[model samples]
Every structure is written in structure tokens, then in C-alpha cells.
Target: MTLRHTRPEARPAWRKSSYSHNDGDCVETAPVRASVAIRDSKDLSVGTLAVPHDAWTYMVDALKG
Candidate 1:
């Protein structure tokens, strides 16, 4: 199952994805609690999708392999 939530008033250090482009297709991520927060780089007010650290790590590793 996945968790869904919104960004808090005090935001963390969000970083855009390396695969992002100037055409507005990009994602920003930040580490929060035991999960990683993800949001659209073009719009901060949209909300965030936070996923577990293990899920994030596994996805990243799979992408690299």
C-alpha cells in the first residue's frame, strides 16, 4: 500500500531530479521522517508523495541496474 499526504508549512530541502529538463517536466524530493517526499518542481503547492526509504532505495537501485 502507498501513503498519500500534503506538504507541510515548514518545507524541507527539496531537490529536483537529475533527469529533469527545462520544459517543466521535473520532480523535487526531500527526506522526511522515515520516507522520502516527492513533489512537482514546477509547483510547490501541488502536494507531496512520500514513500518509504526502502521503497525509494529499491526503485533507485532497480533503475541503476
Candidate 2:
């Protein structure tokens, strides 16, 4: 499966991680079809990291372990 990379926009509503603290070091995510859009909550204009749904699930599972 080919993963397409697209520029992140402000149209999608991004939500910050629940584990994030008030220190300003938080990650935000936006659901985009079968993919997920991630970016730093502090500076959204910088860019975003897009990952496939399965890949994102694997990452979260690994992080939990």
C-alpha cells in the first residue's frame, strides 16, 4: 500500500494527547480517513506527520509495552 503525504491544514480539528501535561510539550492528532495526522501542539504551522491507521495502532501498542 502506498502512503500519500499531504500538507496539513487547519480545516481538521486537532485534539491534544490526554497524557500531555501543561508544560507545552504535547502532541495533537487529527483523523483523516484511513490515516492520522499528527503535529506538535505548540507549533502547528511547522508541519505534521501522517501515518496509516494500522501503523498508528501499532505505534500506540508498542508505546504501551
Candidate 3:
């Protein structure tokens, strides 16, 4: 996959994680280019963390560790 460093002008389609509860502190993710866009569910207007597929996999693995 080709990776391009670009930011979306409009807001991304943010979705709350299934593990999120009504209490808040939710995480959201969206597809942006060849990377996964991650942002706080409460702050959609702010910037998102652009993670490449490989890095995203590593992140998930680390989180599971």
C-alpha cells in the first residue's frame, strides 16, 4: 500500500468503539488514505492520529501485551 501524508479538510466519519460505555472516554477511528485515523470520540473537530497499517497492527499488539 502506498502511504501519503495528507490531511482531510472535512471531518472524518468517526465511530465509537464497541467497548465504549455511556460514561464516556471513548475512542474513534476512520479510514484516511492508506492509514487509520484515530481521534478521541469527544473531540471530532480536533486533529487525529494518523497510523499506518503496519504501525496500527503493532500498536494493537502492544495494547494486547
Candidate 3 vs. truth: CA RMSD? 5.6
Off by over 4 Å in 2: 1-10
List pairs with backbone clashes in candidate 2.
none
* Number of the predicted model whose TM-score against the real structure is largest: 2
Put down candidate 1 lDDT per residue, 5-62, tens digits, no spaces. Answer: 4666555777888889989889988887888988886775777788999999999999
Residue-wise lDDT of candidate 3 within 1-65, one digit each (tens)? 22234566644566788899887789987776677878776754665788887898898899989
Taking all chains together, each candidate's TM-score versus the true structure is 0.72, 0.74, 0.64
The residue-by-residue lDDT of candidate 2 on 1-65, one tens digit each, is 22245666635677889999999899988787778889887875778888999999999999999
Between candidates 2 and 3, the TM-score winner: 2
Estimate every model's Cα lDDT from 0 to 1. Answer: 0.80, 0.80, 0.73
lDDT, candidate 2, at 22 = 95
Scored against the true structure, residue 54 in model 1 reaches a CA lDDT of 99
* Model 2: lDDT to the true structure: 0.80
